[model samples]
Target: MTTSRLARRLLRPPGVYAPQLDTRLLLGALRQEHLVGGAELLDVGTGTGALALSAARRGARVTALDVSHRAVLTARLNARRSRLRVRVLHGDMASLADLTWDLVVSNPPYVPSPRARVPARGPARAWDAGPDGRAVLDTVCDGAADALRPGGVLLLVHSALCGTDATLRKLEGSGLRAAVHRRAVAPYGPVLRSRLPWLRENGLVTDEQPGEELVVIRAVRV
Candidate 1:
């Protein structure tokens, strides 16, 4: 990540997890592809406002939404700190107001652990994606088509262990042509690893799968 990006991430409130590599990578990709610029953008699950701020910096009119009130406040504070204009709202993906965006990006809760431990101060809607880890992703995939304008794009991040194949299928089933634009493997972290057995028992993970690796999937709304 560039120094500016790092600074922006660090400016977020203390409780928010600083933007991760996947978030930076997606933002970089958006800039490289010229997919964002003076367009209306919506960021779902905009924790710490990484993607939202990045888009705002790139001249996009951004609306960032999170189900957690703290996250919304944190994101708004972060946007002000960064001196970027972004409208931060507290809402779920499905309940977002009727508005069309030229680009939609989200780093949603795709962890598949049944008992995933998250920061007590963090938003439950920011983590915990249900047993299969597809709850939030499913909502985004289903809602994106209607939320985006023609030739609009939707970028998402998730874990490889959470059935990447099925995720792509769901996106396609929702009438969005999707692709894996970037991927990286990192430590699964202690909390997700500790809940592995429960995840497997609940059919969230397979016995053959290891407890690491997250896949960042970026899709375009056709």
Candidate 2:
């Protein structure tokens, strides 16, 4: 099989978070970094290991983290099948305290839900963040500076509905220089389409447009 076709086929298994436009979007920005092969990289919330695998393919020393058991297993399988050495771990950012990386990338659970608290299990755990959609995003921003080496870079992607300005302010407050590196409009997926009424009711969506703006935030620790 051709490389691209094989890559698409090996991407995900049942019940794992499939790589979507957000994943592709992050990878797109990553390519712009012109990262050296030996760079230490971390992929947080690494669904299906797509981003992690991409970096590994480019010769990065990659460590991937996911809260879901299935995602961890899937990522490991993909890594092994592709003959790449990715350290797949099952935990959140708190679990990586002792290690530091030159670059950290994440496509976290940023969908705003009606619930006040985040889910611990089930498919919702992959995407159903709290009401304002910044639950896990906040968690990552809180410790990203500490998780990086000096001069490290953190690349993260999420919806604009979660407040791009808020993410920038939080990262900057934590002592990192941050900015929105890219923005793209994506058609609402099943999750957002189902929440249209609730989103509109909450004023998260101002018009009938069936699209959401996604922003890739890049933060650097100097």
Candidate 3:
């Protein structure tokens, strides 16, 4: 896909999660894998639909889902604006029924928050994963096998603070072979910087650290 072409098509509405470095990181992970034409792909927590469109550009039949109404609309708008055929659904993984995919990709809410549970509403829900930052990430791992067909793949991106080994174990426990697929250290974003006090208080990060390492975890259903 052409850079300018994608740039022109992506549209992020106010209050919806915008495409960010993690989005690009997952895109990079997807680029490394070779998906044949018509491969069924699902992008969980689709946000602005960036990954969904990217997969569509690669000839995959892409289906994207999100919990936010605004995000669902934004993704659908972008898909229509680009004239790409994408099925954008308004719901979360648990609400999605009886659909299996050849490949599943996600950039879930993973930033740590002081709260013990993920937010049910507000923009904070986009990134304020609870306590140890694995709220939604854990769910994704738990459902990977059910979401994919036999031998299908899953690509997920999240911060190192969330514990890569934890995700690997969850996926493996669910009958998928998993590994770290890619990694990049990124400076603290607005969300992380805002929660520095809680993060530091909980020993999630050091007082002087400037960044967190983002990792892409890839899993294959056996």
Candidate 4:
């Protein structure tokens, strides 16, 4: 049971899984800022429990939830392998039930295209937000304030070309103060590439824009 095998087994889907770079970057930055500790942490869309495990390693009490059963199982097994305790569950993001936390982190679905291609077995529920890429983000923004304790924080990662501005607006509208905490540029995948021209024609992207990029937003529930 290599770590990669464990991760792959947990994240194995029929199509493509969103890369874990954004989650890693956000967690790394949180560590640098002393944001996460042994506090109660909730990781929404916890694919393979990457962020959950990372936080657990740093002594945070982590609860990771995903809509995918395979993803939940993979996260549990990964936690066992790492000798960390992360409670993984299968559930919808908007309806979290009675659970609450001091910190909530998510890499929700933010694909703007309506027909984006994703792996069938991967945690697509965590990637394909909606037609404009703000479906899941809006819900997260709406639910985060109730999910977190006062002054708690929520970190989200999404494509800059999608609905980053809209996401910020939703968070603010939800009474959370939001900020662009991090940004990273990367090439768009096949799906984004196929839709880039359409997005450009619609003024979503510039004519000479390279591809898609990612922006990580950190918001606090005040």
Q: All candidates' TM-scores?
A: 0.85, 0.94, 0.94, 0.84
Count of backbone collisions in candidate 2: 0
TM-score of 4: 0.84
For candidate 1, which ten residues in a row score worst on lDDT?
115-124
TM-score of 1: 0.85
Off by over 4 Å in 2: 1-7, 208-210
Query: Which has the higher lDDT value, candidate number 2 or candidate number 4?
Result: 2
Q: Give lDDT tens digits, candidate 1, residues 84-131.
A: 899999886667648888888888777664544433344444566767
In candidate 1, the residue pairs with backbone N, CA or C atoms under 3 Å apart (3 or more residues apart, or in different chains) clash, namely none
Estimate every model's Cα lDDT from 0 to 1. 0.74, 0.90, 0.88, 0.73
In angstroms, give how far residue 176 of model 2 lies from its true place.
0.8
Higher-ranked by lDDT: 1 or 2: 2
Ranking by lDDT: 2, 3, 1, 4
- Kindly provide the TM-score of model 3 when superposed on the true structure, using C-alpha atoms: 0.94
User: Could you give candidate 2's per-residue lDDT for residues 1-222 as a string of tens digits?
Assistant: 233553485657666778777777788888877678699999999978988888998889999999999999999999998899999999988998988999999999999999998998888889989999999999999989999899999999999999999999999999999999998898998999999899999999977666999999999999
Per-residue error (Å), model 3, residue 158: 0.6
lDDT of 1 at 34: 64
